[model samples]
Target: MSLLLSPFDMAGTPLTNRVVMAPMTRARALDDIPDDHTVLYYRQRASAGLIISEGIPISREGCGYLFNPGLYSDEQALAWRRVTDEVHAKCGRIFAQLWHVGRMSHVSIQPGQAAPVSSVAVVAERSNAYAWVEPGKAGPVQASTPRALSIDEIQRISGDFVSAARRAMDAGFDGIELHGANGYLFEQFINGALNTRDDRYGGSIANRQRFLLDTLDALAATIGAEKVAVRISPFGRLFDMQPYGDEAETWISLAAALSARNLAYVHLSDQLTIGAEAIPQGFASQFRKAFRGTLMAAGGFNRTTAETALAEGELDLIAFGRPFIANPDLVERMRHDWPLAEGDRATFYGVNGAVTRGYTDYPAYQADASL
Candidate 1:
């Protein structure tokens, strides 16, 4: 059996193990630049086989949260360089997760308080975005409806991704991962219910996928194909995403298309949200057969299940999100079968320096910690 501790190679990079720290939104950056605190937070989790950084906005219009980082500015890229250097100092490999939130955003967080942009003019349900709480405070606010993007604007957004990829390379990241899931910008394009455009960006799967694929091709052309990866959620219904009858077929087609790119990997996020339906069994195996490259699966996976999947050749890597938030040495704990600590939910998305509370304060495994 291939234990979770087994070493693996992600494209050209050699991982110390198969454990990956999944990308998570930590509203810590100021003016979209990673501050000194953000560097310390990632440095604490550097023991992971791979660390996928939190979602980074590609441009001012792409931002959805008050303190989330962006890569368009030179100072922002330089700030991220500090984080990459710190993580590398511990011999850790990291990837930047490029993001655009689309309709799941509020005007308060958008550029000049403009309407959030997406494939269609739609409102997200059961969603919230981080916003300013007071003069200097930040908190969650209900998401606002978004305006549809023009064809020219969509092209501009796609081009912005290429620029972000270059900025990520300049920031000293090992690679970059495109965030295509969770009813964000890409899902707004991929999901038929949300993308009701009459032009080439909607109607058919190929058309709906054009925007994402174009961005992918552009980024891959700017940065090497092997250095790019993408994450997708096939059955996810978060942020008011409605499931299409042909959802599985749509994703299968995407997986097949991705196989031709020779990209680093494709991460599959399960529908694990509250009230969300579970994905059908055998979905991972089907995707693996079509993709023909490194495959990663996240959501509700533990050591025993991850080992079984690896042993059975179902997944090449396993990404843990919440576990890594509270356990910086999650790999070491999993290795020793140590009991994990529960994270404080209130501190998960805090602001005003409280972001550092639940972030870097988590202790590594100690012999005295009750198992």
Candidate 2:
């Protein structure tokens, strides 16, 4: 049997297989709350060993796009509970991906139409935020210039994450994965070139990594460390993240730091599939050596590559993003060597007059009756 199809234990969580459904933003939550459509969508893809949900904004201020489901309210938590119940009924495990987009946001989508806040007062050049273009209109607009977060505000945001994590547990999530990658809030502070602040949250490598580590510690204190995971993109240039000195050392040091925390896992988000530079060669092994725990990576992986990585001990689990969109029975399809279906790009996001059109309309693979 291929290792990719074998069962594995993630911390104490038992998985039916080693294939994880990587989080992808579908943007179907028109009201910033999970609805029946959200339940159906996840239920259809429950075959994945574990499902990491789409980036759910921790608060309105953390949101970068319109129509994203959030976890900062009781009503939203209640709605997500329904989705989690259904997925659990199918014997599937799901993790809530807590997200904060930081400056990757427009004032139009921000609360009170205020400027987005980040580690510093810089704008992401050539980056776009999915927000309002005009009254009652929505589209991609240039990300707004952000104000630097004060010390008090930074602490407040960390508290917001802890609050969201508690809500995630109430929503019946098996665990919570912090969105620390892709030049988001965490990366905005981690990147030395961008975060030039002369405070405890910036400057030296230790200081730069303080925010994420401190927040992770707080989350672990609130929820068991075994129930917490994080996703990061090393050397990622998404949203105009500039490569900085000590980039390699920064990531490796973080891996070593996280190793001591005894968390669930460290997910590496490779940017190759998203049209950004790929993670440097041999870096996964370097990270694997440092982290010493269940390590997962997602980007341009198929069954063959996944199995190869697992066989070589480079990755304990493989995460599939776009493939899971059209192939709800992705694990079974891979197990039986069935051909996969492609998703429609046009209907990947937004309601488009039919919420289920591209969201839950993908049929499971059926063997030919003639056979």
Candidate 3:
């Protein structure tokens, strides 16, 4: 049997298979709260070995997009409990992808119309935030310039992440995955070229990575390290991230740092499918050598490629994103060599007057009678 179809233990969390459902944001949470639609959406894809949920903001200040369900408040936690309960009932393990969008945000979505905060005062040119273009209407707009975060504010934001982690545990999640990838808040700090601060949080390579490491350690202390996972995108040029002198050194050093922590896993996000440069060849193996832990990666992987990757020993687990959108029983289909269905791009983000049309309405694969 292929390793992709086999069961494995990720830290203390046991997964039924090596197939993970990658986090993808579907703007169905109209009120920034998970509702019945959210419950149904997750429940349909409960067959995945692990489901990393779409980014759930730690606080309103951390939000980059409209309609994303958050994990800051107790009220939001209660709403998430419903989704977790349904997924757990189907014997699936889930992790909330806690997020903070930093400069990739607009004042329209900011609290009190405040500017978004990041490691430095800069604007992510050519980036857009899904926010209100006008009153009562939400669409993609150019990201607003952000103010630099004060040291006190940085500490406060770390506290917010810890608070959200506690809420995720209380809501019955199997674990929490820090959304440190794709030029988000964590990446905004880690990228030395972008985070040119004069304080302890910038300058040296160690300083640039200090924010992420510190926050992860705090989360591990609050919850068990075995239940915490983090995702990173190395050489990721998304959201105006540019190449730096120590680009390679930065990521490899982080892999080593994470290795010592004994966390659940280290997930690598390859942005190839999303129209960005892929993680260069041989880098994954280099990372694997540095980080001696369960490793997972998501990009574009079909059944053949996924199986080959597992066979080659580069990735312990393979995460499928868009495939799971149209095929709820993705594991079953792959195992049986069944044909997969394609998803509609237009209906991928928001509900255009039809709430569940593209969200929960995708049907499972049906067998051909003449086959």
Candidate 4:
């Protein structure tokens, strides 16, 4: 049997296959609550062995996108329960990705129009944030300069993560995945160029890792270590992330930390986006060596590449982002070697209340395509 099609146990959860639907933000939720559209969007992709939901802000302060969902409130958790129930009814396992945008946000998305908070007071250049100051005016806006978070604020934010994890469990999610990648709050804290703080949460690698480590420990305590997972983009410069000299050491060290905790998996968000550089050829092998747990690699993986990676044992599982977006039945399509549909770029994020157009409206493969 092809390794990609084989069933495996992810931590303690049994998976039907090795295909993972990588998380992508659709921004369909309003008032930080998941709606019916959100439920259908995830239900359509229930065939994936695992589905990681898009970045969910832990609090109002954690929000960056206008319509992105949150987990800090009972209403939001109740709304999410519908999503989790539908996915589970369809025999799918899903994880919520806890997120905070940090300095990559505009004032409009911040509480009371306050400055976005980060490890350092840095302004990301050439970055656009989704801010809805006025209901119809929500689109790409310049990222605002952020204020450095004090130790008290840092502890508060970490507590927010714990609360979100507990809320995820209450909402019936199978597990929770920490959004520690792609130039978000956690990544900002780890990047030396972005984190210029002199306290326990910055400076040396150990210090830089304190926030993430502490959060992970807290989440593990709240939701069990076996159900915790994290995603990281080691050399990512997205959202105006500056290159750091200790990139390799920082990421490898973080991986070791995750391994020591025996989390479900460590998701590597490699250079998979358009025009992004792929991680150096042997880096995955090196990462797998240092981290002795399941490793899921995301970013532009096709069936052949994913199979090869799994067969060679470089990765325990493979995550498909764009493919899953275009083809809800991505696993079945890949299994049958069927040509996949392409998702509309315009609708990838959302257009007015037409979020369902590009989300749940994609059709599955039909026999006519082969003729």
- Estimate TM-scores for all models: 0.95, 0.99, 0.99, 0.96
lDDT of 3: 0.93
Best by lDDT: 2
Candidate 3 off by > 4 Å? 369-371
Model 1 alpha-carbon drift over 4 Å, by segment: 133-137, 273-275, 368-371
- lDDT (CA) per prediction: 0.88, 0.94, 0.93, 0.88
- Span of 10 residues, lowest total lDDT, candidate 2: 347-356
Q: Write the per-residue lDDT of candidate 2 for residues 1-371, one digit (tens) a residue.
A: 88988899999999999999999998889899999989999998888899999999999999999999999999999999998999899989999999999999999989999999999999999999999999888888999999999989988999999999999999999999999999999999999999999999999999999999999999999999999999999999999999999999999999999999999999999999998999999888888889998899999999889999999989898999999999999989999999999999898877788888889999999999898
Q: What RMSD does each model have against the real structure?
A: 2.0, 0.8, 0.8, 1.7
Superposed by TM-score, candidate 2 places the C-alpha of residue 110 at a distance from the truth, in angstroms, of 0.8
The deviation in Å at residue 81 for candidate 3 is 0.6
Candidate 3 structure quality by residue, lDDT tens digits, 112-149: 99999998989998999999999999899999999999
Model 4 root mean square deviation, Cα atoms? 1.7
Query: What is the C-alpha local distance difference test score of candidate 1?
Result: 0.88
* Residue 322, model 2: Cα distance from true site in angstroms: 0.1
> lDDT per residue, candidate 1, 277-334, as tens digits?
6667888778888999999988889999899989988899999998888998888898
